[model samples]
Target: MQEKAVVYINSDDSGRGFLGAGGSQALETFVDEIAQNVIDPQANVSVFDRAKAHELVDASSAKAKKEILERKGSRLEALGSGSDFSSFLQHLGIPTLNVGYGGEDGGGEYHSIYDSYDDYVRFKDPGFKYGVTLAQTTGHAVLRMADADLLPFDFRSLYKTLDKYAKEVSELAEKMRENTEMDNQLIKSNDYAIAADPTKHEQLPVAKAEVPKLDFSALKTALDSLKKSADKLALSWTAASATDADKDKLNKLLFHAEQQLLSAEGLPRRPWYRHTIYAPGFYTGYGVKTLPGIREAIEQRNFTEAQQQIGVVAGSIMQLATYLAKPL
Candidate 1:
């Protein structure tokens, strides 16, 4: 058995994880940082961020274009299963990333007759330039990670990502509360008139139960602790000057830091996925659900479960923070 895992990176020319790549914000930052050094004239790569709307980051060779990549959006989408990175990140809590170029091709090729040489030249990659650039870009990522003195990881970025997810879940609960109240008010006012046939009287739908306010204090407190711990780790690592053997030992600890996020019980009903941070949508087969326990509960209108999941996710985050706080 291996003592520790360094990192996991999955790159596919055709198939990739659903929605976007699965990783901490640091992973996206690391990839973008290295990609800037790649001088590719043909394949002007643009990065899509964590947001569903996809604020683009142009990681091209040009100076103006490359600078814009960081300013706009600089994070990766939460990864879901259906690609190679799933098992590593979800099950084992390995620090994972999926790197590839996509979202540009307009769906037509299926590796079938439509994907003929003529169509490929016109629609897909024009001159196989993207392929060359892909090799160069991915190559640099691999080499840098393999050669870095101290496992090129930054926990501070991860703490910020967790903070963002916590806020998003709180907002999700709030929005649900607002919508539920409005719908219930409409029900009381008897506003279920059929649009197609106003004359055809229909039974009014039963009023939904009012969404109660969820307590997010636990989550907020946990995130605050995480921020402090992450900052401490970052500051110490920057100043440390250790022997090669000591550095290797520290790298091993960093390698397994993500494993601290896993819960023994796992998500609501899925025990196989232990990580609290990223998981496949139980219903949206090909899509991702970040902070799955909390997000999915809110989405399914299970406020009770949502309340409980907030604690679960908070505990997990706190555990990760505590793990990171250990002397480096």
Candidate 2:
């Protein structure tokens, strides 16, 4: 967390990258390597590793350079940033760039009891330059997203993310089924009289009753159908440019269409959040539980519940695409 630490290269912040051994060291190495090799090399020697506050702040260049720096840090944090933005950037195919400023927030009540007007003025962002950096960084992101025609959504990234999650859920269900069989065996081996308890049952907590084999056929069908629907809508939007009125209406409608994917009810229990695309775990506050309905079902050992949620989510996806398919 260097003062005025700037990144040298453009990065895609996945937010789950720091999950293994040596993650912090790796982040330091990544930033140090990129700064030394890329950014510092390109800039005037005076700006090369100044190790102090930037005396003259250039908002425009800082904005561009900040993106590069944010990307690099994002790359390292992707190993594990431990925030709500993780799944959207890492798993949901969003080309996310985190750009908040001030290293002081990294420690000492910055995010806890210590972070206050007094502490901020006394220790962190004393000059308010970092706050300026934050403003510039946010403006840059907003401008980029607003001006871009493609909405910055990359379905390929989302597809891969979903595939991995699906595999994890499938494996968990299998493990539960395997454990159930093991329990049945241990029970049969017990001596007949003592094994059957009358008042105080000593029977092993039954492994979640064998989970039935799920037919992912329905899910695959739904995904394929949605893809076709999305493709059609994309084509329509592109063709609508011929009519100014239609184009304007299409743009506005398409812009808000994604918002429809969310459910105000949120997950089964947690209600504070509303986005259907992502959510925090009910138990793991800051941690994301992607496809919470299915993931939690498996984690809770509720196989039938998991299957039901799968259908629910699959339906949601298709419905979103169908909504997108409408002509403005």
Scored by lDDT, the top model is: 1
User: Candidate 2 residues 119-143, lDDT tens each?
Assistant: 6665655565445434433444455
Candidate 1's TM-score reads 0.84
| Tens digit of per-residue lDDT, candidate 1, span 187-238 | 7776754333556665657788888899999999888988998788777667
| Best candidate (score: TM-score) | 1
lDDT for every model? 0.73, 0.47
